[model samples]
Target: MHVQKHFGKQGILLVNLGTPDEPTPRAVNRYLGEFLTDPRVIDNLPGPAQQLLVRGIIAPIRSGIVNPFKPGGSTKLYQELWTENGSPLKYYGEILTEAVAKEMGDDFIVRLAMRYQNPSIADALKELMDAEVSSITIFPLFPQYASATTGSVHQEVMRLLSKEQIIPNVNMVNSYYEHPDLIRVFADNARDLGPMDQWDHIIFSYHGLPQRQLKKGDRSGCHCYADGTNACCSSISRVNQFCYSAQCHATTRAIVAELGLSEGSYTTSFQSRLGFDDWAKPYTIDVLEDLAKNKGAKKLLCFSPAFVADCLETTIEIGLEYQEEFEEWGGEHIQLVPSLNGDPRWIAAVVEMLREEVGSNVVL
Candidate 1:
């Protein structure tokens, strides 16, 4: 009698936040309908209230469904962000998926999915299941751990996997906010814009989360909302280990250190706050105001570290919108640092991270 060995390819699923399929109002409406309704994304409201608010008011108004005569504010921004190939979020995701697949060679199969749009997580998971991979590693593209982001992706993945009869060994990456390769990529991108000393100031802007959501994520009950100052979020600790704000601060520190930026030269702030509710404080707009009006700072460089790819937020909001505002506030130039889109170095870094994950797991 003779026995044969079995070998199987590992599955790698990369999930981004999401993007509208198209730049039109109706498309954005559809996209926001799915995205804003996620309980994790809008955890402050009850399910029924969340549904009603999002469907009845937020989505429709933002997408111009309520008043068709005037185009929604988001519609114009998406139009500006759109390219010949469509949404940069999805396009870059596709490019990344293909690059990772090729780099991993025959040993791995990589798939890309968006949490709330086309190329959904369901279809991507189905493909991996169909391939009968020995093990599955879910790598959410979000660098920081936020219940609304990495947490939501993990929950969705588990929900989808729960229906399968035979589940392979599953592993999910929580966050890589301080990954050396990730930090280096950001620093290198900044360096490419000539010398860093020319800029008067730098801003590290992460997407804002509601303050209520931040408090809700804190299970220890001793931090987050304990103080009104939010000084607790100044550094990472076991008490607030999973806090998004803390992770953002840590990420900024890492990038600043890598770039050899001195203290007081850079500031960390949050952007893209939705609704009137209180969000992470020291908002990016306020920071911009202080830098220009009070400090008389000009020629600022901004880094949106929370987002790995350039989307509406980075390109339109920071690049165009902020630039216009900064100029009005007596600033000379507000240079937007490029994101790690399809750069070969970024591709290599992602491959290295995936290999590390795969190597640590047991195959079949």
Candidate 2:
């Protein structure tokens, strides 16, 4: 048996969607290699088959290493997103973790980890385990629950804990889609962009997942309507609770209500689809195109509620790339509301979540 040392009574592990350590092609390749290889992420085939596809096809195409078609494609994206504080995603996560740790005080030791990169989940758990924590609470940064993101984090946590004979009492925050505090933060961010009426249209663009993933998550089979309307995915109830698309819609509704936005003032779409075996309908690009071409909307405001912190997807994909596309389509301006990355409100929300989970007896 391993030596047991009393380090802390409780440990908090904050998990975020990973980012590359640096903006180099090698770093991007390494990060993507690990992230895309996960079964929960790809999910199209069996383990060996997935690995073959990832190592052979996806990784090469993304990193632009093997083939001559697009060298440093991902690397270029990373370059544009690089900040003085390093990757904005990781930097914000570190700040948020520190803020939460301070809020939690001495009782709970907080650690930050990326699901796919440096300060990995495996290493973070080991640190907590070494501390001999009686209980461990895992709070994934994903506000909305998805198998590929939150589910993958849970799976990895369990996989690591399985090796330890003395497993700590584990608790995971599955999703906080309608958390009032979270909704307030998002609404507040939108308000910071000045007036809602000043913008022609608001787009709540969330990360896309294959339709198959949605089907797999559908326990009721009746949930996840193909039309992408409020009738099915609007409410947060037991039947369609685990549905990511439904949860995304729920988040949009909550924020819009918080911001006093009326129906038809905003629209929801999915972004970042890969391979495209029919992802969540009405892609963000398509939505932007329609708004500019048919609707004659000039200025657009976008919100990516799927991410709590700004990453390449937010900073580059929506902020830079989407702006360029919209401009090409005769749109004058495209603004992305900043993510709740270490914002005072967001920090308070996280602290509140931890307190609620840990209980008053824990002495936080």
Candidate 3:
């Protein structure tokens, strides 16, 4: 008797942070509750305390559910961020996923998932398993490595796969902070805006992580915040290889090198900090203020390398909110370089990265 051999396609799971289902207070509230309560996000807090803070207080307040008279802070931002096609993050993820799938052809199956909310990791994983892929590659859409983002996504994927009776070969791309293709795409986007010299100053604003969390990731303990300075994060060493701030700096350096930006012509700062705890320093807001007020900066260009796609952070926060504040400080314009949202080059870069991952894996 002859037996049939089973051949399976490779699986690609691309995950982004997430967005609310709707631009409503309740939806935002639910989304925030799930996001903030993750231990990796609010790692400093214990489980019960974190739950209370997120579900009982923080989420309600941000969603504006506690006070019906006022529009929710995040909800209002989401409302402004929503487009005719819906949330840009999710929309771009969908487009990118479809593009990657088509590019990969019949050899691979690609799925897009959000770490939180709709099109969840669980469902994505289920689909991949159902497809009977021989292997699955998990790619979190964060340029830099952070416990709260990439680490969290990996943990969730493993947790879901742990329940399965048969688990396929798994690969996770932790951080591609200095990938040449990624840096080129960003530089190309800025070039499309005209010339690098046109802007008074360039700002590379990355999402902020609490200083305490940064230190927690440092096994050396003495590496991060040792001398009450960010000197340790200036360069990436084995001691700080996974350091988020160091990775962010590295990303900026790559882009700066590509654009031939002068040493003082560009600044690296952190943004979207929460709870007023000491976060990675030289906050973007402070940097903007100094440029406009003291340095007499007229035109500014900002790049949010932390985010691959435009969402509330890039569109509303940097594009609108920061622009407004800069103008208040007498600045002329704050140009936000577009993110890698379905750009043909960006799609090609992603496909290249995924192909590299798939090529490296042993076929079953």
Candidate 4:
């Protein structure tokens, strides 16, 4: 039994997509397997079929997929990811939590947990429950609400609580993509890059999804169109209406307005395609290549807004693969503007997210 001690209040859990215990093939395989096999994470797809596709196919494909993006592949990319502390996500989570604690100052217990692998959700929740917290606010760190990402976290938390002997009052912060503070963070990133004048195009690349899964996500039965809507590619209820794309566009618009960039100077695309099914539209790689081939666009500035912290997808895939591909297509100077990992403004945003959701007195 989780021995109850002095009763306090609820806690805040900043849940993120976790990293493997180590950066190795075995661990990565296991982590990838857990992440890919989730029906909700992959969404709209039925069981055994998904497994046959992921486990049977994607499993063997991992080595090949990750090879070109690994640290061995790009030293500059790896350097950008490195900090004196550890993995960028883990480090930034700690930093944001600490900053949040600074802002909140111990009124509420603030903690961080990954959806899978080290600092597991169970461990974080157990700690909170041990403290006899009255409630919990879950901030899954995906800006866009996708069934696969935020929905996955929600279900995982519920699943964990269902198995628990005691439950705490919990409020989930589903999406803050439209939150002004978050917009400020993105704006800061864009401004930090100086003028948007040098770049030929601004592409906001999001994590891709199978188009069939996205279509089936239309719970409202009216989300099949391409326009950015909450009903697009999610269970269009009160919950996942604000997913990655909707938020991505909102951020893009916010940044564009902030920078006063021209109408056609910026665009959005999806990256990191896994299987051969229809995912989100206007794939990033295809867009990059086309921009180079036709528009004669050379210099580019790419952003992965779905991720607040740098990771393999952003660092390796986009910073390396996408950059290389751009250069291959005669495009030059592909600069992957770094994410707002622990940026003072981003730290402020995280703090604000906690304070607004839970209260001002929560632990940072």
Q: Report each candidate's C-alpha RMSD, comma-separated, in the order given.
A: 2.8, 3.8, 3.0, 5.5
lDDT of 3 by residue, 132-233 (tens): 998899999998999999999999999999999999889999899999999999999999999888999999999999999899989987889899988887
Per-residue lDDT tens digits for candidate 2, residues 47-163, read 988888877777777777674345568877887888899998889899999999998988788999999998899989988988888889999999889999999999999999999
lDDT of 1 at 3: 25
Stretches of candidate 3 above 4 Å error?
1-6, 67-70
**Candidate 4 global Cα RMSD:** 5.5
User: Which candidate order results from sorting by TM-score in descending order?
Assistant: 3, 1, 2, 4
Query: In angstroms, how far off is 332's CA in candidate 4?
Result: 1.0
Pairs clashing in candidate 2?
A: none
* Candidate 3 Cα deviation (angstroms), residue 189: 0.4
What does candidate 4's lDDT look like per residue over 1-364, in tens digits? 3423325766888889887555544555566677778877776458988888776667435632345354322233334556677678888888887877677776678888888777888898888888888888898988877777788899999998998787876788778766788777776777788887878888878888766656665566565655643334322335335545556666667666766788888877888786577667789999998899999999988878888998878878988778888888998877887788888888788877776776432432
Model 4, backbone clash pairs (residues 3+ apart or across chains), number: 17
Off by more than 4 A, model 2: 1-7, 67-71, 226-231, 360-364
Ranking by lDDT: 3, 1, 2, 4
Question: What residue pairs clash in candidate 3, if any at all?
Answer: none
Top-TM-score structure, candidate number: 3
Judged by lDDT, which candidate is best? 3
Give the 10-residue window scoring lowest on summed lDDT in candidate 1. 1-10
Stronger candidate by lDDT (2 vs 3): 3
User: Which candidate, 2 or 3, has the higher TM-score?
Assistant: 3
Candidate 2, overall lDDT? 0.87
